[model samples]
Target chain A: MRSKKEKKEIFLFLPRKKPFTDWSKLLKNDFKLKHFYKSKDLLSALLFSPPQAILYYFNRNRTVFENLLQLKHNFNLVSLAIILVLEEEDLEKLSDDRILSLIDDIILTSSTPLELKIRLSLCLHRLTRISDNNPLTGLPGNVSIELAIKKALESEVPLAIGYVDLDNFKAYNDIYGFSAGDEVIKNLARILQTTILEKTTNAFLGHIGGDDFVFIVPLSMAEEISKEVIQKFNALLPAFLNEEDLKRGYFIAKDRQGVLREIPLLSVSIALVPITKGKFKHPGEVAARAAQVKSVVKKIPGSNYFIDRRA
Target chain B: MADPSEKRKEVKKKIRKLEGLPALPPIIQKLNALIEDERSSLTQIADLIEKDQVITTKVLRLANSAFYGFPRKVSTVQQAMMLLGINVLKILIMTSSIFEIISKEDVGLWEHSVGVAACAKILAEMKEVSDPQEIATAGLLHDLGKVVQMIAFKEDYEEVKRKVEDGLSPLQAELEVFGIDHAEMGAFLMMQWNLPERLIEMVNSHHDLSRSKKYRKESALLHLADLLVHARGYGETTYVGLPPFDPKALTILKVDPSEIKEIYLKLEPRLYELKFFTEELKREMT
Candidate 1:
């Protein structure tokens, strides 16, 4: 039912809700779209629209930012965006100095006042929610993995820690600029998410900031997730590296000091450590142990290593 | 064909005239003259200040003001001298002579003047220039015109104050008030006192360095030093206007604008030292 021109241009389809909810108060006034969702098509005929109120509002709330990012429109984010401006009086009222002050105190509640410790514990229950994890590789960041391991340990459950490193990232970064390196990081992030998270009941995926990731999965699915990571990575990684690099038997990589060195072609090294309350006092210790085992596996050619806490 | 030094001297003399500037106490003049003499002794210096009961009292008060952090009360001018030493005595003489009870009613004027004096001395020392002492003397008197304006044109001065707050240059604000500025008056007083040509030029060109014909180097240095002090936001709120920025002044002084922040950070710790220096000078004057 879309016109040829409409089909060519990309647009984000925000949920069309009637009369907006009280939750709309969390949104900055600038983000509100003019021309309420009366019709299927977006019309730009409204007067008193700020040229870019949405940009300001988007900065305040990144979920709306994620909504903007989903827009398939080929235009740069700036050119494609427009905001619904309010009257001056309304803008001033919307700034809501008192509400901001109240919210500041509310957020501060968790971070302060030892006398309110009991209240914070009660409030703490509300902040915890289940998290989605990368499936192709389960590795997330150290912080989340530490939390996940803590949760697993609390319930005396089996928790698996996976440390994922790209086999020869430096060579790719040297050939392509840092932007391409960032893509590799993102692509690998998604790989881990898809491989390790898709099946596990409770999993966490995080980027440990640059080329490294950590994943925490229930110990029952540890071997399954580990095999999926290696299988998917082997299948997907060749496509990411260019044709010539793939042709060469050994991929060339720069070591830490930037001298070019030959590295064994595209492979992943994962260390699966089974979390035990006796040995793993904290999630951090498990992640650290996994990293240590990862370095040892990285020494071997093309592999994954799993250390049962019993061993 | 007025040299900046000559112009500055002419201005200071005029300011001195306008204010009927009270004389420096005879004891201070004697001490200053003695210090300048080929043969001057600590005992002689101490004895001269001791002759005046008021000066001795002031000297003892200064020694106690934590400027020295002396272990025991300094009961006499000699005891104060022994506690502070000769370098401190010289400073005491200079500050006391200039500061003479600048009424607290006009809170920051004296403070600003002292801050400028210390800044000029510090700057001159950094340049390894000769006679940082004379530079300090010049800076102390540089704002003599403000005093002149304060006394002569109170109403118009307020207008100038408003103009400054509204963002006019201090020179512009001064022209609105007394048809001239403190730099001009300060220079005139320096000339009347037969101060060195360097001091005179410093006063005249402290505000408008680029305009000076002679003593350009001294004027530029003075301008740079004045801006540094003004930026410090020390002293009184009565600085005639926002201090002007002269690119040429910094270039002449070989001071980078970026370096100002780091240099100020280094100088912050020395504020108490400068305060002590000022308090010391004030005591000697009394």
Candidate 2:
């Protein structure tokens, strides 16, 4: 529904009965601003039509600010820039990661109109640069995926980087059409995402384009998360396949060579590459090891995962 | 009075295009408390959500909406919560309107649905059915048609309730008043929402076992769970006594007379737990 030509929408939540700086005169030319005096109105509007950014003037309503931050995190509203307008004394609150991580940028209440304008533009500009989410699943794309892996490699904590892909996906697309294929991919993405989230909060999930995905979790949680993903994928697969194909457990589709063959129904293969302090030098090395593990996992039966046990 | 058949068609059309349904205020309140708490696990939140059918269905509808591109794939609350995440859930609970100014009767109906959900899960586990949580979901949603009737067809719903009070059976009153029963009406909405076919089948056939073909066992389990919950007097329905039970449900689900007692024993504690939670919510509401 969003078009490039449309004026960027920004929601402004300001304190009631306060003599704060009016932003309408400054922002009217470049943006569409809707003002909200009540927190409920602001939240409901956010749900109905999420603005590109929320300009919240901080005051005594710290709870409202926290709720906004939580909403931004939970909904994964990466594109919604939350710019806080607070007094200089409020700068101490920024030290809290919970508050710091959620807000896109901050502006002082005493700042000139020009400073506010520049900061808002910079926040919006940064969102475009960092938004590497896959269009299909809205998950972090290849760019973030690589950065997450690189961070894991450099971090001292042991972590597991999982490379997930679908088995027989090409055949599924050929038989059921492209839309159906996309549904399967999204389903897998959900399974991976939710499973990872359910297991631990300190995890990363990204869509590496098409049917492939990448998830990074603590090393101890890798196998458990993989098992859960496989279990959930197998459980939810029936909804995507036709009843006849589900009953037969396979469908006759043309192979890459153009010969008819009994292709198995969709299943997931997760290649887990564990990273210790110095197990891998870079993200590429991790990918190469995952490729080797993936070959082994794909060769086995339906919805399987294999962890690279080698040093 | 309008022709029941004509009314049925109109109601079906409305439900097919139904956009939103209100949830019980108490459930929404409980959800807020749970979600705001820093330590509430996803499973814990999903457990509370599964107790209320209206919220459960709404959650599933959002997850399976065409916008998500996974229509009919995300059936259970746990799965839907995973995909929707905790943040969206906070907004959903905050934004969800209260059920037409909550009444004691609506709270009772909520209790009945939760009781049936608990009983169905126990039965599913006893029978070793795959995805007991899903069967529990079916039980929770079995009376979604009643909710639709109450919200969309208020006059006719009161008429049906009055007829039941006048000594007619609930299903008979429903058929005479609306040309269709709650089971089928709820099923139709579920189908329109693109919920899983198995779930739709179970909801459609909860009152009538013969209507179920593929998921007869699940339907039968839900049917029995409904009866057991009613008999326990854990919650109130339009029926003064137990609704008609299909004897064949026992055979289909392979439940024995002794096993019924066992299910009751298992259900007692869960209902007790849920009762405490609901009572707390009611107190908070007051």
Candidate 3:
């Protein structure tokens, strides 16, 4: 793009758009970068072409570039300009000149590796997150919870495992249809992500398919958070039901038999044991013991109950 | 004397076999080679591409996408050539070819590749650096190692996935899981392909700019470019999150945090535009 190399000219012009597809067009055409605009023609001469020269281009708007700059990799906008060299002869003499120095300044300010690095991390992060993420309830699925527990056990930590089953959930589901039932389950899940995680707690929360949920708490805070969970459930139960349902002597819902049945209000049945304890050794054992308690709670009239491993 | 050494040797062998993930996918290696050669004729380029029938069709499909946004469907390689020009065409070909290779990845490494590539191109130009095409390539390929891990060690990858979600940098999770990283794999792949040393250096040193002593500036640039995209929060995998800034990288570029934000907003629309093409490229390539 530079002719005769006489005036040692230099021309520079900023492209108005992103991708600078316009600028890309010029470079691909063998035109000197110096020819962007008429006045900018000296760009070729300004830099020591085939000539050695360093260049720089920093993003004009700071926040966007800075946000991108936060990535874990080394992303310097300036060095990317250096990568654009023509890679030819005339290397040394052109090396250190002030007028030519401006070219490096220009290149780096516009685009660089840092920007590219930032862009890739965003895309990769997206690819890594699970799409099946339960939005209504942040609790992980059966598999994720299993892995978390397995890992905790592998690390030999002091852990508390609990299986939480809602009392009268089937009757409720049959009465309200699945949506209202979902709202109840969602309310319960919220309590877990929020109320149950205490400072001393290392929690693993999961939705085991339907009405059953699982929790893994640190040995120290497991009882406190567990008690808090039951209290919270009792406190919040009234809000989910209508005035008529609340005032009614019993919850009016269809039984699994499809006949209308009056049932006690909602409650939770929990089975908890410390991971470090010998009695409830494997996760399956804890789950089975918890299930036994949950099943027993169904036989009684109260809302929810706990399986005291000590008992 | 009965070989305490043999047992050690056996252990060492077992570990080595399990270590160093598969190199970058084969299809990527072939295409990158084809594009890097300036001496290669269009026929050579087209022939090598056509040798893989699936790749050729995908290239044609992507060539027609808005990334190129030609008026008519481009059925032939030459037509694609005429539409996208040599550089853009090469980039499209490389990108499409890459998608084809990464198509099987569940980790969304390929999707992330396209997003980062688009973001990289935008940031490069915004700063007026010449990273548009080349930088985009690096952005897309930076995590090829993860792809290798996804295929080779699914179980470990899943475990590492949770660690990352719970907050571990990709590099850290990698070390935790496989005791290796994409950088080493990338560096090895780049070398195997005999790519320009500069690209290999940039890829290997992207995570740590200080490691790139000879190519310090370029290494630092790639590092910064990678971080910028992470901060944008564009794609899914939120784990292997942003690395801290190197003060030297700032002094060299004469840039500040304020400048990064300006470019991020400016880059958003352009990224969206590229997505139109990238998706088309993926669909066709796959």
Candidate 4:
């Protein structure tokens, strides 16, 4: 069953070099590699079989560089990844900006097998993570949020993780429908992003799909950022709700079990977890802590945040 | 002769001053609004398109065209809407109105457009592109600028044709006489009409595939469709050889050089069908 998956082939175009038999043996199981010796043959082979990726061994030849750039334009380097293998001295001697721009990564030829594997894994991981952004809100999604959290933890920053979601959002969505709900989510994303930008230069805002959003800011600025987000969201709520709903302060909505209830106008609840808790290592731990705070915060009436103090 | 830059400025002024390029029919705007409105129903869009008798007939004809290949005949506006969906139907209506302008100016150009549209449809389907109808629409409207030049600037059009007869390729003649070629002109008109940006880019950069960033694959397919139609001598032409094939576009499109023969073989029968399709449309209009 695994073999039924379409194998992603890589085209390897390299100049004459010593002992590349080992290179072929290295990639044989993972990728079906097609080797091209002459520059002209590379063009023809690319025309016939468009590869998932390209591995080019760099040289100082002008014609080779031109052909590669032309090929990149043809294949759209945005969709396809091109990795360049070059020696340190040759890379310095060539010093060509055009070649550097066309390629996605440069792997020094002197790197060990384990190093090359790790670099390729990291490159693929980054590509998939970037492409996984939410389509509606265009914010980093769950995978990217996890990766960002992991990176922030590794960097040893005094990070404060805030998990934010809407209060009474389900009732609003039930009345207004999915499209209006989507607009509300997008508006919240904008508010969170703008409020964080106003407070600090370095912060990350991510959407975990639906109406849920998460942000990571420095520990000192957490309360300020959360307050600003609540204020901004509160100001925009009247515009989203009708005049009658605004005046009445609540609207008739059905609870999940089909009971009619008067739900208050939309508000937000944010759970802030400071990562200096010593017990939190991975993103899962941070998310678990946020959930515990969120349960307590939702019991309040208006938009507010609850910080986890149970460390 | 004036310098190329000076002549280009003059041509730009001429384009700006010219009138009678049909206003993009009001129906297209309504259709865009309908597409954007979350509450809009398909029946509403179908009823709106049906209000315009001219577009109604064209949309019905396209729904029945060999390109769509519905097993049963799609006879009514509602039936056509169900089969073709809203986006494809929107493009069909837009192209049908645009084709009114193309068919009025020259029958040969109309035939050529039909040929390219058929070829692009086949190419896109073979490549498994998500929207074959959009690609075919791009192929059909790729030469729209030439129609504008023929209608808007007769004297310049005569000079361009004369240069073509004197043995410069059609593109080279267009450049010598008009400063800019028909690709840029068609792209400019598309932009003015508020067509989708991808379609506009396809028209603007079909001649130069490298310049296209977002719609390069679509543009490359249109470029090759134009060349294939010209190769078969089906469209209006002065009998120059196939336009220069960008090796880069071929690579990007992933079309094997050997597959050209197979594509042509598949396109021939479709061209014959579209020929009848064009004539029937013309007869209905008259």
Question: Which ranges in model 4 have alpha carbons more than 4 Å from their true place?
Answer: A1-311, B14-105, B238-240, B279-286
The window of 10 residues in a row where model 4 chain A has the poorest summed lDDT is A71-80
lDDT of 2 by residue, A1-311 (tens): 54546989888887653334355678867888788887766775675457898889877477767768766655566788999888999788679886777788888888777778888999999888777888787788888888998899987878999999999999999999999998888778767765676568788988889999999999999999989888777767766787689879898999999999999888899999889988778889999999999999999988899999999
Candidate number of the best lDDT = 2
Tens digit per residue, CA lDDT, model 1, B85-196: 4433444454453334444434355556666666766777877664565566556667766765565546556777788778887676665555567787656644543434
lDDT of 3 by residue, B1-286 (tens): 2243453344234433432223233445666786787677656675444333234433443433322122122334443333233443443343331222343334345445556656656656765554345455556666655555565556766877787777777677766666556675555544443333555676787776766756565566677766776676544443455666676775655567788777678767866765564455445545
Give the alpha-carbon lDDT of every model: 0.53, 0.83, 0.51, 0.68
Return the TM-scores of chain A for each candidate in numbered order.
0.56, 0.84, 0.57, 0.60
Pairing residues by index, what is the TM-score of model 2?
A: 0.73
Each predicted complex: what DockQ?
A: 0.00, 0.30, 0.01, 0.02
Q: Clashes in candidate 3: how many?
A: 83
- Candidate 3: global Cα-lDDT? 0.51
- Kindly list the per-residue Cα lDDT of model 1 for residues A1-311, writing each as its tens digit: 54443321212223333222222332323133333331112221111011222212211334432323322111111222333222233344436552232121121111222322333233333323322323222233455656666776665665777777876666667766776676556555645654553455367666667677767788788788778667655654543455467678676767778888886665777777776556667766766777778777787787565554544
In model 2 chain A, where is the ten-residue run with the lowest total lDDT? A15-24
User: How displaced is residue B189 in candidate 1, in Å?
Assistant: 84
Candidate 3, residues A240-271: lDDT per residue as tens digits? 56546777846886676777878887787776
Q: Model 1's chain B TM-score? A: 0.60
Name the lDDT of candidate 4. Answer: 0.68
Which lDDT tens digits does candidate 4 get at residues A1-311?
A: 33724556778876556434566567666667788876545654453235666777776455665655654442233435677778888777556766665677878888765566566656655665666667666676788899988877765667788999999889999988886787677667766765675457578888898889989999889998898778767755654666577778897999988999999888899999887634567778788778889999999998999887765
> If ranked by DockQ, best first, what sequence of candidates would result?
2, 4, 3, 1
